[model samples]
Each structure stands twice: as structure tokens, then as C-alpha cells.
Target: LQKACQSQENNRAGLGADKKEWIRTEDILERLEKVSDDRIYRVKDALRLGVPVNSVKKLTNIDPWYLMQIKELVKLENELMKFNIPEDIPEDFFRTLKVHGYSDAQIAWLMRVEEKDVTRQRKKLDIRRTYKMVDTCAAEFEAKTPYFYSTFDTENESIPSDRKKIVVLGSGPNRIGQGIEFDYCCVHGVKAAKEAGYEAIMINCNPETVSTDFDIADKLYFEPIYWEHIEEILELEKPEGVIVQLGGQTALKLAEKIVNAGYNIIGSSFDAMDLAEDRGRFSDLLKNENIPYPRYGVAEDVDEALRIANEVSYPVLVRPSYVLGGQRMRIVINDEELERHVLSIFKHMPDNRVLIDQFLERAKEAEVDAIFDGEELLIMGIMEHIEPAGIHSGDSSAVLPTYSLSEQAIETMKKYTAQLAKALNIKGLINIQFAIKDDHVYVIEANPRASRTTPFIAKAYQVPFLNIATHVMLGSKKIKDFEFEKKLEGYAIKVPVFSFNKFPNVDKQLGPEMKSTGEAIRFIDDLNDPFFRKLDSERSMYLSR
Candidate 1:
């Protein structure tokens, strides 16, 4: 019996070891073709484990040249890891790493130091990046397009004009939470900046966006929205200010880094963004302002999560902090579900924490997109979601000129939004979500940057809200300076468009996480028009499919 038990234990241990080996092999192969959150680390791990390039190529089916390039990078990283930070580092070593596309964040991790230390060292060494122009004709003609790229070279092609310039950092990529809506805002922001007599410069890496179009701005930087890349551009162009609000959370996340490096952020301050995104700070702000919010608790472990779940009374809306598109957000109704979900999340994201809020069942959700300059507030339009509060606003069908909200409720929402904006000192655009439960309004979430509904609100009201918000950010116009049509002649319905047919394996259920890839808009003069309403519904369904 003892021998039998030992055999079983050995088999289990072998199975566990085999699974880990398979995962390591799979992860190394995955890093070759597509980028993962920890692709670099995985590559480094495979190299350290002495995985052969031929083996990686066979598994990943990637080209040998690319594999060799990655191997070289891994070698460099290994060599750099041996050096003591301030003592043994070479003078040109950092520049060499930067030339090979190594980000400061990665170097900081290797050196066991803060990213700010790397930035400070690079600045102290005067190892600056040069900007090269992306003339549309490839230098064949005097091209009017002012696109630029960065490199470690001697001469820079970018020529600063006499006109004041404002750099617009674009939303990096079209992901679930942030899609083309932000790109639309960036494009319009460039136009508005140009119209306001400032040279508009765009910085983005997404080729799929209109903001990357060569003609959209006076100068376009086809580069990643990394702190290192942005710092180079700021040094070269010396723009009057940088606008971070129009680009979604991608740009907003860099506000503090940019500001700490002594770059001027034109619109909403970094403190305002922190206040809105940080759960504890935001909770305190709401408490001080006497604003109503759902009961909530923050947890970093399963015990804390369970405690919070029990305190919040069973049904709780739980999500991780500092995530976009409500990633990994779930509705937990029992301790079992909470434990399972929390364990799964911790397994995947060990460093991240969770927030649990009392779920407001069957509440009506409304979104307000408003522009706020320091002194004045312009409520663009109130949108009422067709679905309940649990569904993400991006995935829900929303109607502008709110179909169900009462005048009193709308006024209350506006008042709350204005108060929050004022308290945050927001200068450009702000989107706030409110839940109406038991005839009381509760603030759900607030995004100080441009929301996904900016374009929808602009089309519904026939006002250039994006452009107006840009001007507001540039301090060229106040909210009251521009006139917006108070009442819409027709109601606009913004329906989410899904690509379920393209990805048959994905579940087709609406939840807090945004799943829709795009959206379609429809207009109706009257909601009571049955024939038109039916046609509109059919069109919306067809488009969504």
C-alpha cells in the first residue's frame, strides 16, 4: 500500500512537471509571432533556459532572421544584466539599448532601479533622440505632410514653424474599451488646433486609425505612445503644450510621467486624472462632496475579497483596478463564485488587486458627455442606455436626448457632473455614468478624458464637441464661447456593432466588459413613428450582426 501511494505521488509530480514544460515551450513560441503582455520576459526566459533558435522557429513557424534578431536582443539583455547600475555602466550603453528598441521601463527592471532613475541618467548623459520627417512623397517632392519618426542620429529633419504647436498624443490602439471614438476625437482635435492657429502635431502608432492619416494634422509622429518616444518629440518640437485628455486612458496614463519630466499638459491636470481613477481618492472625493455612490471595498487577497463580498451583501460587481474595457470584471452573487473568480484573477494577475461594489440590480444607467472649461460647463447631451446598468455603455444601445430620464433626474445628473468636474478642475471633456436606483442617482464611474460617446454626442446634437473640447484644452475658447443647439430636432440612436460572426468561439453575452468592436448611428424624428422605428430597429440589428 505504501509503494502504491508513492507511485501515485510520482505520477502526479511528473504530470505537473510535464504541464509546466509544455507551458514554457508554448509561451516561447507565442512570443515569436504575436506580442503578449510578458513577451519580452518570456523570450528572456527561453534564452536563459537555453532554448534553441531552430526549435523556436519550428514551433512558431516564424522566419529565421527574426528569430536571430530576438536572440541578439536576448544576448544584449543578458550582458546588460551583469553590470552594476551607476558604477559599472558604460557611457554609451543606454544609447545602444535605446537604439535597439529597449524601453526605459524594461531597462529599469533589469537594473533593479526606478524608471525615473533611468530617465534622469539618460537626460544627464544628453543621449537624445532625433526626429525624422515622413514626407508623403518620401523626399521625392516638397511634401506638405508633416509626419515624423524618431531615431538616434546626428541630424533631425523636423523643422519647427514659427506658429505655436500643441502635441496630441493619440489613443495607441483600437482595443475593446477604447476604439475609433478616441481616434475621431484626436483627428478633430488636430483640426481644431490648426483652426485655432496652433500647429497640430499627432503622435500615434495605430495605422488603423484616421488620426494616423498624413493629412489629418500639420505634423504626425508615427510612433508608439511610450514615455521615451514622447519625451524625444517634446524635446525636438518644444510644443506649447501636450493634450492628453482626448486620447482615452492610454494617453491619460502617461500624464504624471510627462508632467514629472517637466512637460506641460494643457487640459485636465494629472491630479484630476488620479482623483478620478484611484478608487480610494475618488471615494473620498465623493464622500466629501456628499455624492451618492455604491458601497464598495478594495481587496488584494481572497480573504479580503470574501470579507468585502459578505459585507457588500452577496451580489457584488467586482473588477480589477487600472484596467480598460472592464477586463476580468464579473458579477459575483455568492461566496463560491467570488472565491473562484478572485482566485482565477489572482492566478493571472498576481500584482493587481480587485474592487467589490454592491450591485445595484435593474437600475437604469445614463451617461453624460460634457465639456468643462475652468469657469463654464457645457452639457453636450445626455444618453440613456437601452440596457440596464450592468451592461457596458459602449456595448449598450444609447439614445441621445434621453428617452426615459425625467427632466428632474437629468438636471440632477447635470448638477452632479458639473460639481465633480469643478472639483477635479477639468478643462476639456468629461464623461460620467450615473445609476438611477430607488429614485436616487448614484455615480457609477467617471472618465475625465474623452469617452466613447464623444462622436455620438457630436452627431446627435450637430455640434463639433470634439473640436470645441480641443479649443477648450488649448485655452483658446471657453465652454460658453461656443453655441450648441440646446434641443435636438431628432433623436439619435447609437447601437453597438459586434463581430460575433467573425469569431464564432467568443460568447455573445452583454456584461460590464465592452465586447462590441464598432457602432452604428440612426436618427428618428419621433419615437412614436412605428414604421420608421421598426425599420430603424431592423437596420440596427443587421448592422450589429
Candidate 2:
């Protein structure tokens, strides 16, 4: 049991728990080994945190005599430094040195010891570094399976068996502002469905993600989110609804494929998602709704892209039609860079259907993570980026209760966000990013699917957006039936973690592109603790680093 506990302790480290609970060794050794009084007296103080001898013997079934010898040796070796002794000192001399501090020459004169005895004792005290292999069984015991993870709540919901099965598509990997946080939405949807007695499925490829954990959904496909593969799942599951809105772009892009294949889209309909994205369509929405947006032009070829770029002016933003993790998005500062980027994006897409828009300079970036039951607009949390508009939000240090924006700007943000959610007919979570300059607010991007801030806000605000979305999809929830009067008063930071340094020679840049592998959530309320907050933000206590 001692060995078993130690094995589990080492394995638990992978879970990213800060200040892990540790064990002790002396008590266990003394009791189990039954050491002679002389040996015990010689080496007792050197042992670290561990179990008692009886407990160790009860757990490992090792003989007491051998354990005694090992324990005594460990004690003698470890305590050599404590006695102010040299590395060459023999164990017998430990008693002499403990009584008095001395150099090798003085000890040799009094105890008839060799000068080299001091050196030997110090060397024996040095222990080799030990590395433990992670025990897979620890995960098996602590983690949930695909089915049970969906029901985090102890309460149960009553639903008919005829209810349509719904599965939320998953955003595969970690990106700045994104990561396991996206799965918070995924888990929410699953739990909602399960509570309402509906089957919830999740389709994703990233194994390291939280949603992929065994019990997040009723059934996890562990499949890639591509048109080819998703179409097949639609055919088999024949789900009454497919939740494209909570899964991010991977799910959003698949929405059309499902519709074209004549399958039902669970949360936001294909048309609604299209209105939110499809640069041309979104532009039309801004015009129809009288919403403010940056000037934009869709280019079909390099010549067209260059022409549109010229019209939009230098330092314009260009984005490809269907990409993930901000695959080919950038601010081209000059014609040369523009030319190279355009060619590269065109080469990546080949067809060249990209949108170029004017870059809003020096604007504060804000985001609204909201929920809608396809009717009532539920504002979960408003997230503001510390970085300016040009930085990929996922890469930016985000804060709740946006500090710098004017009240009017925040109002405009909330209004537009609600409007966007309602217009898109979103039945789940929606994360919208905006660039606000002075009194003017411009639409940056709106994801009909679960935005990166889902978990951060959910945890920060103490609201259950994911569970609500699932209930709505299953027709268990009605808009306006429930109300919330919560406001994000305190601050929360969703800081991104990177392994680029681990990948030698990796280019480090934050733009309208995502480059992050994981994130940590922290609740902060102190202005005086900004430095501590910043340091706390460096490493997350809950993340699997």
C-alpha cells in the first residue's frame, strides 16, 4: 500500500495539481524495520516524509530486517551534511561530528579518523535522482467515462425516450484563448442533454482535451471534425439535432455539410450560422441590421486580393474562407509582405476565396460570451482582451468586466452581442469578439459555436451555460421561462500557456492568429496583487501541463 500510494502520488503529478500532497518515510522505516537502538539512534533524523514500519510491512510484504538496514543506510547517508562533516567521513564518525562541528584534520586528531573520512560521509549522503513512471491506473480511478461525465450534477431530469439524440462537435486542439475551456461548453451540452434524458454525443480528435475524457458525453466519437468524417457520423447517429454552435469552427464548418446531406442541425441552424460567418453574408447582416463593421472586400484571386488590399489600405487583415486556429490570418504591413502572404494563403486554399478588411488601429478588443435558447438572450460574461485589437484573442490576456471601455461601448457590445445571438438563433453558447475605438464598436468575429471563453466565464460567473444549451436542444428549455440577474463584478483571467520554447526555433508572435496549447483560469480581485496575479497566471493549478 505504501508503494501503491507512492506510485499514485507520482502519477497524480501529471494532472497539474500545484503543491501536491506528499508522504513521509522515517516513521514507516522505524516501525517496520525494527532497527537496533544504536542504528536507529545513528540515522533517525535523516528520513523524509513517509509511512511507519508496520504500515510499510503491511503494504509491501517486505522483511523487517532488510528494511531496517536500508532505512539505517538512508538515514546515515542523508544526515552526513547535517553534522557539518566532510563527504569522506565514515558512518561511525557521524556521532563524533554531530556532537561538534570540525574540519577533517581536527576530526582525524580526536577520533583517530582519516581526513578522507569526511569526504566519504558527504558523498554517501548524496542520493541519486529518481524518476517515477506515471501509473495509468490513477487516471482510470479518478476520471469519468464518456457517459457519466455528462451528468456532473447530482439532479436528474425526466424526459421521454423519443427525445432526439444530440451531439456537440468538439474543437480539437488548444489555441490561445481556447483549449480545454472550449470543452467546458462541450461538457455543458452533454450534461444538459443527459439531465433532460437525451443522449449527447461529442465528436473530436484531440485526445488530450477534457471533453475526450471518458464521461464528458454519452458517447465520444474521438473522430476528426472534417466534412468527410462528420457526414458519416450524421448518417449513423441520425441524431435529431447536431450542435454546431458549441463546437467552434470545426463544428460550424460541418453545419453546412449536414444540412446539404439533409440532417438536422441541433442548436443554431445552418442559415443562422451562415449569417454569422460567410464574410459576404455577415457584411449584409451589418447593412441590414444597421450594425457598424469595418470596410471589407472578398477576393477570388491574387490580382483581386491585391486590388482589394490596395483599396482597404496597408496593414489590412485577410482571412481564408474555411480554416481553423487562425491558420492563414495576418496583418500585411507592406506590399511585399502582402504579396507573400496572399500567395501563401492562395497556395493553401488554391481557390483564393478570402476576405480582406481594414484593420482598426489601437482599439480595445472586447468579447461577449452569451447563451440563447433560440429566443431569450442570456449574457453569461463579457470578456475584454488586455492586448489591442490586432492580437489573436486566444493569445491575448483576457479580463472579465472590461476595465478601459466606456459604458456606452460596453452597452453597444452587449446589445450587438444579444442581437447577434438572437439573429443567429443560437440555442447554445456564442462568443463574439469586437474592436472598439472611442465610441465606435466594430464587429471582429462571432463564433456561432462555443467560444474560447466558455469555461472561464462559466467558472467565473458561476453560471451553467453548457447544461442550459443541452436542455434547449432537447426542447426541455423555453426562452424567457428562466431569468438571471447576475453581473461579472470581480475579474477573471484566462491566461494561455505555450510550449513553443520546447519546440526549438519556433517563431514567437501574437497576431490575429492563434498559437497556444493550453490555458488556466484564475479568480482575481486585488489591484495591489497585480504582480502576484501575473505570477499566478504563469502556471495554472488545474491544468495538465
Candidate that scores best on TM-score: 1
Off by over 4 Å in 1: 1-48, 142-144, 347-351, 528-545
The residue pairs in collision within model 1 are none
For candidate 1, give the lDDT. Answer: 0.79
Write down the TM-score of every candidate: 0.87, 0.65
Candidate 1 shows a clash count of 0
Candidate 1, run of 10 with poorest lDDT: 9-18
The alpha-carbon lDDT assigned to residue 322 of candidate 2 equals: 61
Question: Cα deviation of 175 in candidate 2 (Å)?
Answer: 6.0
Model 2: number of backbone collisions: 38
Tens-digit lDDT string for candidate 2 (253-278): 66776888787887667887777778
Report lDDT (CA) for all predictions.
Answer: 0.79, 0.63
